[model samples]
Target: MVSFIGMIKRNMLVYLKDRQAVIFSMITPIIVFVLYILFLRGTFVDALEKYLESAKGLIDEKDIDVFANMLLLSGVIGSSVITVSYSSLVTIVADRQAKIDYDISATPVTRVKIIVCYLIAAFINSFLISAILLTGGLIIVSLLGNTYLSFINVLALYGITLLGSLSATTILMILVLFFKTTNSAGAFQGLLCAAVGFIIGAYIPISQFITPIQTICNLFPGSHITALYRNVLLNGVIENMNSSMNGLDNGSLATTLKEVFSLNLNMFDNYIMVNGMLWYVIVIIIVALIAIAILFNKLYKRK
Candidate 1:
């Protein structure tokens, strides 16, 4: 246990000492947030307006703005949880490149202990950053002055962020060992930055795609996690809008909006609710952790 904790501390200190790696790990989500402010926010608002074309004056425009921001915020959190976790694990690749893993293997620490320490350190670091992003997002959205996020909702957001970080850590742990050098990991991070936005429906919503494409994206735990975010953050605003409209569209608009933004996914012809998505994410984490342990034995190749 002492050696495990020491390894964790050593890994964290080395990773944190490199400011550029830390910054670039978080850069993907920040870039997505910036893009929303510059371009996508207006497009979403217009889409909502188009949806409400019949009852143009019914929905509060401020609420629409708030709703749009909720989507952007959720997408940012979703992308960050994975990107940050992956970046945190990049330290493992660097250690391998430097033959540091060889030195560590000569110690009393078991291979499992070393690997667990790597995951634990990454999880801690990723969750801390994700929590910061969540707090900042809530603050920014609150500036619109009409958000409907309750204390319970805030707690749930934190809960989802926790699960998100864990899921990302275990999932990425299996993938990280495939790269024995920092350069390969760095290149993959770039691809991940570009792909995650689409995978989680940040760049374009999963709803806009065909059924098969939607299924492909939704297969990822990150996509379901993002769906969880959409429900928690946007459901409150949606309730407010429904009250304002007084069932004006007979709940059709709310349902349509949910589908449009992927507040829920119709998988296997069944709608997946919060509890269902939670289960899915939990299952993914379990499977990923098992895979990581097995892969470490097979592929970590400590030399």
Candidate 2:
């Protein structure tokens, strides 16, 4: 256990010492937040206005802005999880490229301990980065939208963000093991960082995509993580909207907005609830962890 902890500390120190790499890991999510504020925020508000026209007379305009900001914040958290976790793979690739793994292999440490140490370090770094992003997002949303989240909602967001970070880290660990060089891992990470937002519907609403594209997004845990985050973060806003427009047939509009923003997903001709999505993410994490253990064994034998 002591050796395992030492390995984790060593890996973390290596990752943290590279200031440029740490900043690069967080850049994509920060850019997405900036773009949403500058460009997409207005577009979403304009689009939502048409659907919310009936409630305009009843609801305050500021409330609508608050709801929109909450929705965007959820997407930002989703993007942060992927970017940070994927970027954490740099530590694993660095170990291989620097032949640090070989040095560790010559010691008394078991292969499983080394692999677990790397996983633990990655999880910690990714989770810490995600937590910072989530806090910043909430603060910005509160200031910009002139609203505050409930205490329970804040706790729930932290928990969900941690889970999302874990799932991303586990899956990436498996893929990172396949790369023998830092350059190849860096290349793939760049592509993933660029495209993950679209895949998880962070850059655009999932509903705007065609059926096939939507289906592909649904297959990944990232989309479900976004859906779960939105479900919690925007629940109050949605409820207020429903109450303000009571006795009105706004069910279709409400449902459409939820689907578009990834608060829900259509699965096998039926929409899955937030609980169902949470279970799906948990299952993915379990499967990915098992795969990682198996890959670790295979690589150890080769070493």
Candidate 3:
């Protein structure tokens, strides 16, 4: 057990020591926030205002801002877990590039232990960074105005974040195993950061996309994870706004936004609820882990 922890510790150090990996891991998340403040925020607010056409006079503008920002917050947080996990896994690719993985595989520690250590370290590193992003998000939204994030809501997000991190770690591990050089991994992570916000409905609502594109994004677990975050982050605010409007045409807004944002997803021609999304992500993680185990045997030295 101690050796296991030590292996994990070594992985963590490799990730932490590479300042480029650490900074780039966070860079995409920061860009998401910055883009939201400068561009997307106004766009979202305007789009939401269009949705509020019937109840404009009845609803406070600040209420709209709260909802928009929370939506942004959820997306930003979601992107972080994915980007950070992929970033943490960069260490594995770096090891491969350096031929250090060959040395480790030759050790008596066993391949399963080595794989598990890398996964655990990535999960921990991603979750920690994701948690910090959540903290900053909550604080920023709170300072701006009323955020619906109660203590329980925050705790639930942490649990979801944990799952998101693990899913990302497992999935990225499979990708990492294919990388013979850090350059390949680096290039992929760059694209991941560039695309993740859009794919996860962080930048634009998936509903606005063409049917096939929307379907493709829904097939991804990260999009479903964002759905979970939306439910936790914005549900309360939706409920309150509904009450404030008092049937002022917003009674369906909850249901509408759920559809619009892919908060309640459709899978295989069947509608999926929040709980279904949870299970779906878990299933994806399991599948990814199984694949990783198989790949390690074939791709890495099985010694």
Candidate 4:
């Protein structure tokens, strides 16, 4: 047990000491937030205005800014989870290419312990980075939208972020295990950073896509993670806005907005509730972690 802990500590130190890895891990989320503020924010706000105008006084224009910020903040958090997990993968791949794993294998460490160390370190790094991004996101939302997040909401955010990070880390660990060279892993990581936002519906609302495209996005675990985050982060603002519009049907507005923004995922003509999605992600994380451990054990025995 002590050796397991020591391995985790060593992996974390190696990862954290690399300046390039830390900075690159953050670049994707930073760019997404900047682009959303500069361009996409206005576009979403304008669409809300147009939609509300058609509603004929059913909704207020003042609420649009708050809603847009909430949506973008949710996307930013989602992007952070993917980027940070992949960044941790870079370290693992580096170690493998440098034959650090070979040296570790020569030691007394069990293969399962070594694999668990990597998984634990990846989860820790991903969760910590996601938490930092979430904090910055809440601050931006509060300052720009002039709204405060409730205590319950903050707790919910932390829970979802932790789960999302774990799920991402496990999935990336499995993917990285297949790569024999850092260059291949690095290339795949680059592609992932570029496409993950769109694949997870962070770049655009899932509802705007074709049915097939929406289906594809729904199949990805990150999309479900994004949905869970958006539901918690935006539900209050949406419900509050819905309440102010007295003539609107109770909960209708909130439901519609959630659907339009992909804050709720549709599966087989039914939307998966947030709790169900959380459980699904948890199951995936557990299964992936176990599978990777078994695979690594076999590889170690062969060696």
Give the per-residue lDDT digits (tens) of candidate 2, residues 1-303.
Answer: 787888898877777788877887877677777887798788778877877886778766877798778777777788888877777667877877888778888888888888888888888888887898789878877777655468998898899988998889898888898998888988997898788888777778776887778888888888888888888887777766767777586566567668667688866556788888889999999999999999988875435
Q: lDDT per residue, candidate 4, 96-169, as tens digits?
A: 78878788888888777778788889889889978988897788678776454689989989988998898898
On TM-score, the leading prediction is 1
Candidate 1, residues 1-303: lDDT per residue as tens digits? 676788898877776777987898888788888889899998888888888787678888899999999999989999999998998899889988998888988877778898999999899888888899999989988987678988999999999999999999999888898998889999999999989999999878888888888888888899999999999999998888877778767898888889888888866556788899999999999999898889888876566
Looking at model 1, the pairs that clash are none
Looking at candidate 2, the ten consecutive residues that score lowest on lDDT are 247-256
lDDT of each: 0.88, 0.80, 0.86, 0.80
Q: lDDT of model 4 at residue 185?
A: 84
Q: Least lDDT summed over 10 consecutive residues: which range in candidate 1? A: 264-273
Which pairs clash inside model 4?
A: none
Once fitted onto the true fold, the runs of candidate 2 whose alpha carbons sit more than 4 angstroms away are 146-148, 250-253
Whole-model lDDT, candidate 1?
0.88
Q: What is the lDDT of residue 130 in candidate 4?
A: 89
Question: How do the residues 61-160 of candidate 3 rate in per-residue lDDT, one tens digit apiece?
Answer: 8888898989888888889999989988888888878888878988888889988999999999999989988988889889988887789998999998
Give me the runs in candidate 3 sitting further than 4 Å from their true place.
none
Which has the higher lDDT value, candidate number 1 or candidate number 2? 1
